[model samples]
Target: MAGRIIQVYGLWVWVAFAFFIFVLFNQSHSPLPHSSGKPSTVKERMMRAEKAWETSVTLRHEMANKHPGYPRIPLFPAQTLEAFGKYPYTIWDFFPPVYTCPHDIQRVGRLGDGGKWVCGMSLYENRPALPASKAGKRTKPGTVIYSFGVNGDSSFEAEMLARVPSAEIFAYDYTVASLGPQIAGPDSSRAYFKQVQLDRMDVLDRTPPFMSLQTLMKNNSHTYIDILKIDIEGAEYYSFDSFMDWCDRENAGEMPIGQIMIELHLTDDENLNFNRLLKWWERLEKFGMRPTWLEVNLLAVTLNPNKADPRCVEYVLVNHKDRKNIMRQES
Candidate 1:
């Protein structure tokens, strides 16, 4: 009886051990959780979330850095605030400050009631002076002020010329928007002064009668240009060099120019970056011109540590001759 009892007890113990082993193996392989007493802390969860977010941001920044192109830098909030202060004025007003650019027979400090000034991508401000005479006299009927890239809009230039209506202004722009052939006439408001000259050539292309600046001046019999405004996109870097050469030839024995206004384009292109900008500074210095107004556009950020955007600031160069004249009229 005692032996039979021992055998049965041994069998029961082995069954119990086998059941425990089965449970342990099943728990290890099962996806569902066997609850543990302790729970995750709030601080731990927060730390994990923050770490994940930081990792993501770092990865994105790394990708951007490795990309083979210019990175876009957004304008700072300060720039927007500055832009607002110059309200009712174009982007050019924020630059070169108010009294920086030279004015010819025009008030420099006073703002017009509803008048628009000549505002360009680069720094230039055009304030109109009262007509040369009270009688609304016509000085030179055929006198023309030639601008290369008029595009479609002439409202700015037209308003400036209204102060000097005696001169017949000839603005040349090839890509001007076409309203219609009839709408192209000159009216009291600023419109194209004459028919659109559609010679599909760059200002440098030598295509005969319209090829060179010399030809244009000779054909028009224009001995002098009262106000020369040049804004030809990024091409101004090249065109201005050529134009200066022409000016040297014409002003050899004559007055160089009564007044000059130009919007110089600066870029990070091979021959037109910030270093080239310094070269421009040198050239303007030689011409007896100094920057009266400067407006920076902040076109792009450069990879080169020593370089920055060429158009970061637009400069308005004025002949030193006009500084006293401008200050006297304004003061």
Candidate 2:
């Protein structure tokens, strides 16, 4: 009955809420709270936090209007809010692991160090199923992949090429001169490497040149990236602002990114400024980047004994907004 009502209303929250009121009307006892009328301290705090978020959203719109282009920067809340107890206690508490994947997922790369998970494999498997005798060959029409912070570990990139023969990969790592041994796959020719670090700013003065995502895409003549993988230590904290800025603009072309496989590193700085972290996470969701899968990097926990929470986490996010287009194109 509830399902039928939800389908009819086309808005589950409001429909469910109406059902709740209807059920409460027939109750023997009144649903209203009793006269012990003191306001809830926690509730008051929650309300204030919600108001602050609303104000922040308005400010974000203003910022977007002020700067309408590809390199959109993220704005963080004032530090004064942190001085008061405005943010939540922990990151996990705020971000519950409840994001559900719309399709199946697969793990790519090495088992231990340099691996990550990717979503929407049904579309990725561009070729039809092969017989037992010819199982090795799986050719795809070609998908665009951008990887940041290779760190000489091309296991993931190599594996992705192996799975999708025609896939084109653009890997960046200013620190490393070249890719690892595993990157030398059968179709390794499709993979391109650049000695450039992914940075918030595109500054040529840097040793290897620190370029932003927008600049990188423009340079490569790539309007859309099929898969964007980032494992740049903790640089991801600021790297996404330009991407999100592009999403904010109506003039900017469609963001048909299929998936994002990122390794999030939670350093002491992020832990201290929890609100900023929270805002960053929320902004990703706002841009239709939905977290589908996550795994805590136990290696980080083992290494950082002083930190109570695991510092590194691997996440496989699917872009819900551009998902349909991916399916249609691949189909």
Candidate 3:
């Protein structure tokens, strides 16, 4: 969920955060293992939450002035543990993918083994190929990064192409004409661009309207994609099942994609409701994908909690096989 944890209150590690929260609030944290401290008094909890709220504000100011490029989204007071047992909707945004994992996600930012199993907007998950010139001829990146919303911002794709010359990228969005540098120039990397819309299901056509993941993969002849990154408005749900089905049919045991970093649009579609989407998410563990990072959509949710549930959330899910090497557990 590279869409996750960056100083989410110095959220680099749970041990550091557990110590920070416990020393400040004294409430048990369900996110980490060592946070089994007895729940604090309601008054004490409120005080702690208020302090956290203030810290978040200051952090925001600091990031805005200093590192404008790496912006961090804030969490709402309602979404925090401020009202833990006293409220119902308090947790509408409480989904920590690393802990509850198969169910929901919690905090955001780079959280993984700090090595291979990590997710979030962390660095170097897809390192550049050696000897850039020869690496470009490989025809594909070691990991395939699919960026959806090309809302005139493509620094992520551009950066990855510079680093990982061997990896190929397919950036989509009907709005943009092309993603970054053109694909044919002598200086062009392996990044490719598409203007098609993504949906749950579709058939190949001359028009190439809303296409499915199945069709996308087949058209590219890609049997497997190392990482699937998506941010296509609220259409994430439409193609998730199809992606899994393709994995089921192709690999028989392991899902083809090793990791998925996507911004989920938690829309209230009747057929693909939130609860139903969660059920499908839980099923992912069976295929070896497990949640590792969570970050709420500040623009859609935190900035306006009173409006409605946010449609955008970012998450990073890694495969089961990477647990030992990639999934880092705190000591």
lDDT of 2 at 127: 41
User: Candidate 1, 233: how far from true, in Å?
Assistant: 1.0
Order of quality (TM-score): 2, 3, 1
- Candidate 1 residue lDDT tens string, 64-134: 34433314312221245764453223223222222233233232211421112231211123333224346
* Clash number by candidate, in order: 5, 0, 22
lDDT of 3 by residue, 45-159 (tens): 3344344434544553453344222222222223547543433332223344532222222222223211112243233333556454464455443556565666665555554
Cα misplacement distance, residue 251 of candidate 2 (Å): 5.0
lDDT of each: 0.44, 0.68, 0.55
Tens digits of per-residue lDDT for model 2 on 38-130?
654433533443444446556544544443331222222223556224422233433433445444567788898888777756566664333
The Cα error of candidate 3 at residue 209, in Å, is 2.5
Question: Where is the poorest 10-residue window by lDDT in model 1?
Answer: 113-122
Better of 1 and 2 by lDDT: 2
